[model samples]
Target: MNRTDDISNLFSRFGASADSYLEFGSQFDYKEKPLALVPATPAPEPVVDIAKPVIKHCDTPLAEAATDRVPASSPVHASQSTAPLRHLLAEVARARQAEAQARNEEALRQALPHGRPAKTRAHVIALISAKGGVGKSTLASALATALRLEGGQTLAIDLDPQNALQHHLGAEPDVAGMGNASLNGENWKPLLLAGSAGSLLLPYGAMSEDERRTLERYLDNDRYWLAGQLANMGLGENDVVILDTPPGRTAYLDQALMVADQVLVVATADAACFVTLDQTERLLSERVAMGQAPLCSYVINQFDSARQFCRDMHEVFKRRLGSSLIGVVALDHAIGEALAYGQNPLLEAMSSPACQDMLLLSDTLKTQLKSMDVAESYAS
Candidate 1:
């Protein structure tokens, strides 16, 4: 008479597993009963196909027909109509089996140790910007260096196709890296280069147009490809991963946001960067709504106190972003100089304003990461 009754009738009619039907959220218990057979009798004036099974028919709906007992006076017709129902039941069983296997695989993955103590997992930080030339890659490299300087294990990954991050990390331009490994269907763990700043680097590497397109297509198709790739690297809980994403919105940004524990939006002191703030907030909000990064903060890079307009823009950002403004890095020529020499500015010029600001920012980030409940972020 109701949904449970409908399921019961269907299961009984097809001899399906009542336990499997219960898994569909049905609360009622069901037992299959054999259909009542008609007594053998003589039929005159018409030839009958006795080899065919008798089928009971009624004006009631097909789902309801099997639930009601047929009257003795009702004529029994010979028909072969149940083969399709049997096929449908077989398909349902196969689907259920596949679902069960997938759940088991997921449980096993969660159970396996990740080379870290219990209640810990790597903290993934993604650096993104609305436009290019805002020094996102340089900041990513410096931040990775700063974290490592603080005596933490770190891995910096270059998600941009330009592959410029390896240069800042002191890796040769011609070295094979993540892109090459992926193209060859090989492990990316062995491709990690020892960064000059005491951290590890995963460069995007050199690839042809076809290879780039193929990798981008893969990233577009799988939203969690980056997360899966990181998982295979055997990272410990104390390890921190920094993702240097390309400027503007792309498939790479989407994949990075899917796994990032923190999202750092890089901007400069300018009218153009100001206009993009609202859109950037919306982009991060979408991911937050889907249960991603709980911390999405802003960093004002290249701040110049000497220029009144630069100072005004910094004040405006401070007022607008409030506590979300994590740090204001003073503009310094040493950043470029250090990059030219393939070294981290924080290490090259520790007394410079840019280096001091970066150290303060790194300390703030470390404090925030420690206060966060790591268990909640990586819980099964």
Candidate 2:
């Protein structure tokens, strides 16, 4: 028998259907079409047929395949579906940012005295002069002591490279100070020395010529260097900080002006100071924008009432400066005496005219600061 006939007889003996048996040399035809590889470019808008199943590579990860699937019959496009979610997320991020800012401001207000805001905290008074030997450092130190005695937290900072403010404050001259600490990458808080009447003194410290030049270069490059330093000192809102700068235009003076809440220009009743007023005013005008200058005033230091020339110059200053002339410090022997003895004249010689004038001047300054704070509070 033929092999196909023998296979059919075997299938019939096993009870198989006739259609199930095939001839050995006959071919079987498949009705389904073969799968082709994915084309390089797909149709812009391809319709999907769910009834037909497409075979893909077995190496494709299940997670990737699931993520890539998007039904063609979906009402919303992918971009359109995600747009509202992205906008909502952005709005939530902004709300969190605003909340964080509000918390910081509230914490600042709590840390300050008398509920003062951050803008008015730590009142900075910078003492400057048009020429050397104008008692700028002396006035700065004395003012700090006077303010401290008047029940205000006070700090005196010497920005002058001369480093003479510490001596006036009865601090040791050769001790390490701000410049030394800055050069050595040390904290300035440890350098703060005790001063007369419980005030704090920050000396410029001892520095070599090259070191001084380096510091000047730093100040010149960073306009906000001094300001940033002061902010990091953790001063109370009502605390007073007095900056003693070198006379005339300097990088130190520029930095002091950048942070000073009040500018106290020291001038002796003389031709040098008088002649330099225009130049000093011009420098100040250039440093700060118009209508935003700090509260600036003049104090005539070493005014000798006994001399007609001094009296005439004092009158000229009054005429020239008008209400900007804040006070006059008489040329009292007590001031020089206090310096020689390393004592504060306001504390040592309360009966002296200079002491009385300083007390009055400090009170006047306190009043001005109070007024400023009130105005700012109202404006805010």
Q: What is the TM-score of each candidate against the true structure?
A: 0.66, 0.66
Each prediction's total of clashing residue pairs, residues at least 3 apart in sequence or on different chains, is: 0, 0
User: Ten-residue segment with the worst summed lDDT in candidate 2?
Assistant: 111-120
Model 2, runs deviating above 4 Å:
1-120, 149-152, 290-292
Q: Candidate 1, which segments miss by more than 4 Å at Cα? A: 1-120, 149-152, 374-380
Name the top TM-score candidate.
2
lDDT of all predictions: 0.80, 0.81
Q: Model 1 TM-score?
A: 0.66
| Per-residue accuracy of model 1 over 1-380 as CA lDDT, tens digit each | 88788888888899885557544377898999888698668677765689976655557886667656666577555465345778989999999999997885676456443432222258888999998888888788877877742345888999999999998888878778788787566676788888876768999988989889867766655565676678777777678889999988999998888888888889999989999999898998897788655578899988888999998888898899999999988888888888898776767555688888877887787777776745556773
Residue 115's lDDT in candidate 1: 35
